[model samples]
Target: MGTYRFDPIGEAPEQIRFRVRIGPGYGSIRIGVDGIPQEWGWIAEEVADYRGEKVTRWRRSQALQDLEAELKTVAQAYNADHGSNVMTDCFMQAFFVFVESEDPGRLAWRAEFERRRRDRRA
Candidate 1:
């Protein structure tokens, strides 16, 4: 899977960081409209570094929806033809992390979009 990092919009600085990731071939494949095959599944975690200790938390569906919507836009930019399908595959095999940090420049999901695009062409 590929890992990505970006600061959430209209949020407090250094308060929280968002991380999106696509699979390294995780989950099962399913057929969609017109018998188009795509993967399906998702994992999300909330990790907090508190007092030099790491704690894990569960995320609500809203977080996943936000991430999915953002990634769909990315997929559309990658390949207009099968953007939604490719994005679905990506999301199905994704692992998201909502971290508490301030570092940036870790976006890496484009490679996956390109790979899925190539697969669609094949």
Candidate 2:
């Protein structure tokens, strides 16, 4: 599992408060807010380049069922607990990366996304 802290892109620093822990290949996203935990299933699509064409196919993991529930419910719960809606907006701006671990391309993509996110906040 990989753990990361998600910072709100266009909100005040104090309003940023969410943690995302993803399983290998993003089997799930464990969202936490103010130390409360909620689990959500994650889905991934396989993209391939074949004959100079880009193709994407949705794939399902055998360990879990397809995600039929909304993941934002976790954010809603967090907002209710804090008596504030900041988390809702934060969740709206979240970027969920589904690349293989330690992949250079994915790292670069995430870095650039973060750069843009910071600029938006600025």
Candidate 3:
């Protein structure tokens, strides 16, 4: 099993800063297909950040799409080769947060951990 957390960094002027980290070897294995920087989230800033630009800036340029497409192709190899035995479980934020109520589950789980930690200390 692995764990991930997101954190924001120093107050910025023109840009917001955030970091995404995966534990258990510090995401050294790099299980994902896309170029999600260890210091950033799932979406690569190179592409996702400028998606609103409509191919204007460097991020919206053809190069970015080419990179994203290549990454998708590489990732597809996993499913293509191991179609029956494999499953890449994924969920959208709204789906997991609102539809499935992951927040409640996470809270209940954290509460249990806190209780156990307190018990151990006692």
- Clash pairs detected, candidate 2: none
Q: Residue 86's C-alpha lDDT in candidate 3?
A: 29
Model 3: runs farther than 4 Å from truth? 1-59, 80-122
Tens digit of per-residue lDDT, candidate 2, span 81-114? 3233675664332324322222234445788999
For each candidate, the alpha-carbon lDDT, in order, equals: 0.36, 0.39, 0.33
lDDT of 3 by residue, 7-117 (tens): 122211223222222435432212222322323322223333344553211122243334334444443454322233325553222111000111223445788999999
TM-scores for every candidate against the unseen true structure: 0.22, 0.23, 0.22
Against the true structure, candidate 1 reaches a TM-score of: 0.22
Q: Local error of candidate 2 at 51, Å?
A: 7.8
lDDT of 1 by residue, 1-122 (tens): 87876622332223334443343453322211111111111233446666756554433244434434554544445432323356456443232222231111112355567889999999
Q: RMSD in angstroms, all models? A: 18.2, 15.8, 17.2
